[model samples]
Target: MIADAATRAVAADLERQSAHWVAAATTFLDAEEFASEAAWRSVETFVGLPLRRHLKVIVEELIDIGRATIALTRAARRDALALPEAMAAVQKLRRRYTQVETTLDFFGDAVSSRTSPQLRAALQALDALAGASIAPVLTRAGLAPIPVLTYVDKGMGASILRADIRLWAPGSINPVAAIKIVRHNLYRPTSLFHEAGHQVAAVTGWVPSLQESLGRSLAGDAELRAMWLPWASEIAADVFAFAHTGYASVTALFDVVGDARTLLRWPIGDPHPVGWLRTLLGCAMCRAAFGAGPWDDLEAAVVTGFPLRRADPTVRALLERSRSRMPGIAVACLTAPVPGLGGSPIGAAVDPARVSPAALAELDRTAGAALWTSPHWRRTEGIRIVALAGLREAEQPDKASAWIARAREWMTATPLAA
Candidate 1:
């Protein structure tokens, strides 16, 4: 009872803050009814739910899907949020998703595991609430939605960018909304805001230099894309997330993920930001945003846990001012083909096989029918189809040029499909 009470108490303020999200979403959607093609799709993505309705829907969907248990998901999310190794989280979530899928598949066959409708309903509602809380913030931040966002189905899940855009789209620049959904569902559905922030940053081009630089620096030094993008993106996301949505993101963090992973925090972990540091940044952002919560308890928790500090006001202002430039950057980046072999650090960090499939699905969904399909690159042996796209984008070549080389390499040296 006490635990439940404490949980609810903590959730109260977070809930209150998110209350208007749905209504705001509704207003935005209504206004977006006449949005341009890209805007229409953005609205369509937002069409699925307003802050309130979306939360309700997500809550219901999670229940229907039997992923209603928030305790562990939240714990895992919080724990992993701080863990900077994106691949570790991807690996961990894959294990969890697989375990859940298998267990649910079994339980699906056995009717005895069914819970009461009330419990199911409540679970769904909570999920919707969480989802509801994050989307609007992302939208307002100017992240547009791509119909089939950044999906790369490598089986473990889709390895993908923190969020990606539909360069092929007519004129939608910085589809932050599309990226947010991909981020939210692809990994953990709970920390929608944190992921959305990264999606927005990447989609918006807030830290393109950093992303590109990291990609270049790390590519030469590392074998995997997850080595740095996750950590760097996490910090960048934390900055923008706090800037756009305030401190509830931390609560969302706590509510979603829990304890850090052993492998994730290891200095050797690929996603650069160490787990402890990422979590600390998350908490620090929260501390700065709301000036500490009730009795300064939340503030104390963040300060004690993260031990991270906030960006100076001038820096904050610069980011805020620069927020509007994302769409332009995204448009420019996508229109001009990136170089092959090496390009953006952000692109360099993508490993579709290693990314969460849920994320890829979001990307797929965001891509909105114009799914970038490369036939020859289809999964064969260890070579992933989705990853080919990132490699293509990273290498900056015509689709054929990108895959032909990879295919040739595979056939000559490592061609085992099964």
Candidate 2:
């Protein structure tokens, strides 16, 4: 009779703790940030319809977890055997809590940084670019409502993540695409295009399609397929970037890596090809897009550090072969019609010829002085476009700093349309 009393007391304490947590979770869910009408409308207006739905799904999942916790506690009380079984169920609930917490933490970080005007303006610019430029391309590729959010990070390296993977819920509504970038390196955020290309592959199943294409193309050559298969995604991304930015992407990539010493020693089986080869692929795409001229000069400059005379024979032979085929393969991947998109390639739908070099240069030259005066320029140029061109002319630190200031001013004043 004493032992039975002890078990009941323990069960009561367990129920109390679970109840407290349920209240806490409910309070969090009810906070104005997620639950307020203003918050929902603002998110829908600025973030998009897709993301509003995504946020609702996340909130529902979190609330459901809380309700499940309460239900589990009641079940424990009703069943006498629950004391032993309770630990396993509690452990499972704890894991679910952890998953929800991680997602919220990431969202919190993005929200916190928006308090800075410069950061907020930058994010708005990215969103504007997404709606105006990137979204249409993705929609043509047949993956509508792929919402992208831009956030600042400590690392110099820019990164992208599919929120579906982050949340461990595949095929979730309004799937999130996160682009984390270095705050100061605003000039070459063409990495945004590269990362978006990664998303395109993920969302549209382009990577598998490319893999199958490669398998068919190289059917008899198993060794070549093994080497090429691992590098396919990276190649696709590079091609995609090249398609958008043209030669500007090539120069931006070189600036990001800074030197060619890293390229000389790259071996087979790596995820990325040698840096020189990457630049060469970009050069090839540029040539294909805009007929051959000066690209040969650019390619020669890219290989200056590891000249053919000094290359390891294996590296040299691999380059000689990839030089001929990789370009064609990349161009085909970019230009080939996406299956359901009315016989249009995602690249053609993007019509990146619109990103003109002369216009961008003019926009950079007139930046702070005349940008707001001319409504035509204001409507056309985006942060990534003008920044890339601005950095070309304002390579000096002081000049770049001034340009960034102007960019902030331009971005802050321009309101994104609802």
Candidate 3:
């Protein structure tokens, strides 16, 4: 965690940038429909820009890492260095590399500041739109509004998202939904719509914020318990948006998340489901609701923008895998956790060095087994474990070596299939 003073400085800088971003995202917040659009405008502006910036920085870090690794390899190969000199250099690089990687990959970074207009708009839009969708539902359902903070997050367009939408819940109250929106020439609108889908889950209370889940998981949420609710929540919102608004939202999401705004890069391991998959679900929803004529246009709006790998097959499959109409995010909120976690802190802490290799192996095994029951949740759990390993190493250096050894053991003992 950052020091209070450091955090405060970061917050101040974010405050400076939020204004413009809020203006750009006004439509998404739709706060004019509620409070003065500008009332929370600062934070709205603050969030999206930083989220994008953080993502940009992360992608840059990844680029740096790959470059450094190549450089290291080349340098090592160029000269016959002594063992100690080579080892010292490797260790220094490893530490520096870890800092960059940790800063980039953690879910905490996805939790953008709220004081800035960009930050504020990002939060306000997420909360406002999610609130709009959710407030009505909760009022109808007779549940009081829970105190949940919203953050417009990165990773909504990550390669790790196996589905088109997903959520993370660190607890029963706080929730976050990640949406997949690839960017393009006309991405802002499409991205707005795509995130609207994610908000549906937040409003319904399907999952917690990226920060909340990451914070709690780091704080100690059980892994299995943490993953289930969010997965259901995200999927539910995705299906709902798809079924209700159709590909307009899908296209919106794809356009922005996919587009590279100069220094800002598209995110990796984002909370949202993959854009192509999201398009598939969107098509399914539209056709199911209004018979699908414009889906290709809507879907095409996003795919046309990105340099995607499986463009043809992926696009074809979205419509191909359509199944029974998905229930809403609100419905998902009512769902409970699937069994397991053995009552351990799978969500919060995964200190590999603290546990036996057997336990580490079991952790991977259980996560794999759970995926068979619910892959949506299971994949996140696996990622969470990976993230947790990173967290432990960063915070507790004394345990890092053991954790690394156990991690290796766990990797060797557990199969990626699980």
Candidate 4:
């Protein structure tokens, strides 16, 4: 009789715990906990129907897990196995509940960012830029581009949580490429292309191919090959950005990674190239594509500021050897044909020459003042205008404020896709 009474108590406890988690999962199923209806409407307006449906699908899946947990609890009770079996079932449900909460929190932050009008507009524009930067390469490579979501966060560098990857929820796949753009660099966001490059590299297998190519290209120097092989992913992304945005991407990269003290501070197994080497590689890319430009001056400035004497003897030797080979590395990145790109070089898909100093100047001269004000041009060529603005800001620091204002205006004006 005592054992029977204990079984009844365990069944009741399972029932109560199941009810609590079901309610918890259901709370975010409608997203009301994360945003008000008006705010949600604003998100819907900017993110479009497909992304909204994806979010809904994720939520519904969470709720369905809750339902299944409840069914398991009831079945345990019916089988009179409440003490051990039902208790284990409820514990498993708790673990799943935690995962569901984590998934909601990850997406909820994105949804919450859309509530504020200023941020909403900025993110919407970033979404367009991200799409513009990545679509041509993906389409040319015969892969479909996924939806992109941009949100502002406090950081020096931007990052991406790529779509279709497994999420915290056991069976759930991320439905969008969520790119976090740093607040300070929103107006001159060449980093967006870098993060998008990561997504492109992942989907198209550019990184592994580039890694193999780098191995072959640097085979003559065992040390150089070993050092560069590890940096293929980052180098691939940098190549992607430089291919699409030219010197603007290079200059923006300099802005982010140019501190002299940290220039040679490479941690073991870090995917990023040593900062000084990375910036020089950017200059090499410009030299290769456009020939004799501001990047040469920039490279001189970086080399002068961060001399090899400051580095440790071992590091200095590596830097000295790598300096002469930077141009070759850039060429390898640009000219190599990748299987992911269907035997086409990255440069062929998104040509750097299109955004060269001369080309950007020509675009500006042809568009005149209408480049900033025309709705049609802003919609179609907004990404190139951003590159132009970055170039102008780098070339004419005195007029940076005006260039930034114009870039911000168009970015806010551009519409998100439906």
Candidate 5:
């Protein structure tokens, strides 16, 4: 039953590493500026707060590992099986430690990259988007301080990491969704609203409900139900964005999915629908949220620009079935009363007017300079309005960053209520 000296030495080394890791993680958490400063709320609210919570979990996990290894090593002195358990525990801990390292590395990069103006503006712009568009809906639904953050990825385009396993641990702190977008994309950043919609789905269970409701609705047709099953989450997200951001969300969808190449292809097995169908579903939801005028205009523009002659036959048929059922799906998602809204639709709860495309476009003319001058546009309206306008006015990337910075400055200048 006695183990080789080399194996004993390995077990002892693991125990030491576990203790060292706990110390290092705790020290990092204590020294990290993100944990203390309220001044960093606008920017740090997105990244720093979540990182702090995650690091605490790392520290706790390492401490547990340390104790377990110590016990196992002690037991291994007499029991032969204890060596294997200790070895397994050390191996498992190594993978867990790597996860911490990767996240720490990401946090470090996120912190260091703040020197870039576009990244700063992207952070602020996302904060504004949340404060304006999502916060009210969450507040109305009885969840406050959802704490959404956006990080710039020079390598990737606009996307959301919902319930990311790396960023969240069971029984840890609150869940925060991090939106990753290309640096300085102020004009068409309404994608953040779509991303937030995914986060909302996780927190509210609205998507699951919508999926269930949609499954029941389409149950009469097995083909449609099978197709709709995977797409339920995506549709829920699109509908959520439309309901909250109204015309702005649809316009942004068009911006991203408007091209000819994207419009014609069928995205089989993808969680997202084809680009053309996504634009149309968004329009259908917009019609439900803001009325027909916005939807009609968006639909007409897409049809005129990118006709769907190139689409596959089966895909076209699936889209046709989807379109017929979209209104029912939209109603199901938008009208379901959450905790705080008193049975009103989420759109009406966030912004009563549910801004129109024409109005958003008009506001974009001023590049959101009007937001500072006019008290008429509420903070929610101002966020989408300025983002659209800034993107429209900006001819280059740096200009877009400047526009976003200006918007952030105006937003942070005063405390605007929802």
Candidate 6:
């Protein structure tokens, strides 16, 4: 009789613990958390519906687990055999609670950052640009473009969390492709397309194919082939950005990765290419697509700034061999047919010629002042305007401030298509 009384007390405690967690989990995030209506509206305009639905489903699942756990505790009080099952259920509930907490915290931080109206509008513009960058390729590859949510954060370069991946919460896939655009580069965000390229490559299976093509291209040298294969994902993303934005992508890349100190320092197992070679590879893409232009000047500056003598001898040899094959590597990235693209080269989806230096200049000449002002033009040609802005920043450094302001104006003015 005493043992029976002890068992009941334990069961009651377990039920109370589960009930407490259930109450805590019920505090779901909503627009009420924001300070102003405008803040909530801006966040709602971009990521509200999908994120809310996703969170609701997660909370419901968590609540169901908690209730089931409470039932298990009640069963434990009746039969000793039920005690172990009840304990297991409580453990499972705890695991689930932790997972749900992590998932909610991640999204809560991302959504809350958009409370500022200006930051929200800039991110919205980036969302539109990301769509413009990846839609053609994804559509051509017969894959639907996922919802893209861009947020500004501190960093020198941007990063991405793809939509197709599984999330922290069990049985949940990430609902949106979240791209982090660095704080400083909002006005000249070619890196935005690079992050979007990661999403495109993931959905289309471009990186694996490009790696194979690159391996074949460098078949003559075993060391060189091994060295380049690991960097294929980053290279494919660079190719994607270059395909959509031309020399503008190259120039923007220079600004981010052009530090002379770590230019040739290849960290063990790092996926990114050495900074010097990466800049040159971007220039190589420009040369392959547009004959010769400002990229050559930029390339000359890189070579002069980071002389081969600065690199260790083995690294220098590898760099020399890689330099010779950059043109072929660039060509392989652009022209290699992939099954995801229905056997069409990635270049076919977004022609480099469309955003070539000459093409961007022609667009500027044709559209004249109206390109920056007209809603129709802003909506239709906003991507090109982005390319042109990067081009101006690269070629005409003196006018970068004006271009930055112009970019901000259009970006805030234009909203992503519903």
Model 6 lDDT tens row, 76-97: 8887678878888888888898
Off by over 4 Å in 1: 1-190, 209-230, 255-257, 260-264, 294-418
**What lDDT tens digits, residue by residue, belong to model 5 across residues 126-176?**
656654566666776777666665666663236776544445332334345
Q: Provide the TM-score for each candidate, comma-separated.
A: 0.29, 0.78, 0.31, 0.93, 0.73, 0.93
Q: Assess the local accuracy of residue 337 in candidate 6 as a C-alpha lDDT between 0 and 100.
A: 69
By lDDT rank, best first, the candidates go 6, 4, 5, 2, 3, 1
Q: Candidate 1's error at 341, in angstroms?
A: 30
Instruction: Give residue 280's error in model 1 in angstroms.
Output: 2.7
lDDT of 1 by residue, 7-119 (tens): 54443433332333323323322322222333222222332233224333322433332222323333433343322332233334334334333322221221111133332
Q: Pick the candidate with the highest lDDT.
A: 6
Local distance difference test values of all predictions, in order: 0.33, 0.59, 0.36, 0.80, 0.60, 0.81
Extract clashing residue pairs from model 6.
none
lDDT of 2 by residue, 97-161 (tens): 56655555565565455555555665656655544545666667655566677666776456777
Give me the runs in candidate 3 sitting further than 4 Å from their true place: 1-126, 152-233, 243-245, 256-275, 298-418
Off-target runs (Cα >4 Å) in candidate 2 are 1-3, 30-60, 74-79, 138-143, 163-166, 169-174, 212-222, 258-261, 265-270, 292-297, 307-316, 324-330, 356-376, 381-384, 387-409, 416-418
**Candidate 2 — what's its lDDT?**
0.59
Per-residue lDDT of candidate 4, residues 1-418 (tens digit):
1235556666777878888987877776677676556555654333445656665676677667667767766666566643566677678778877877787677677767775666677777788778888888888888876788787788778888998898887887887888888877988988999999999889888887888777777778998888888999899889988877889999899888877768877778889999999999999999999999999999999999888888888778778888988778888888877677787788877889989999999999999988987877767777788889999988888998988887787667645342
| Cα deviation of 323, candidate 4, in Å | 0.9
For candidate 3, lDDT tens digit of each residue in 227-246? 32334444544443333223
List ranges where model 6 is wrong by over 4 Å: 1-3, 29-40, 43-47, 416-418
In model 4, residue pairs whose N, Cα or C atoms come closer than 3 Å (at least 3 residues apart or on different chains), thus clashing, are none
Count of clashes in candidate 3: 59
Displacement of the residue 321 alpha carbon in candidate 3, Å = 6.3
On the 0 to 100 scale, the lDDT of residue 94 in model 6 is 86
Question: Which regions in candidate 4 have their CA more than 4 angstroms from the true location?
Answer: 1-3, 42-48, 74-80, 414-418
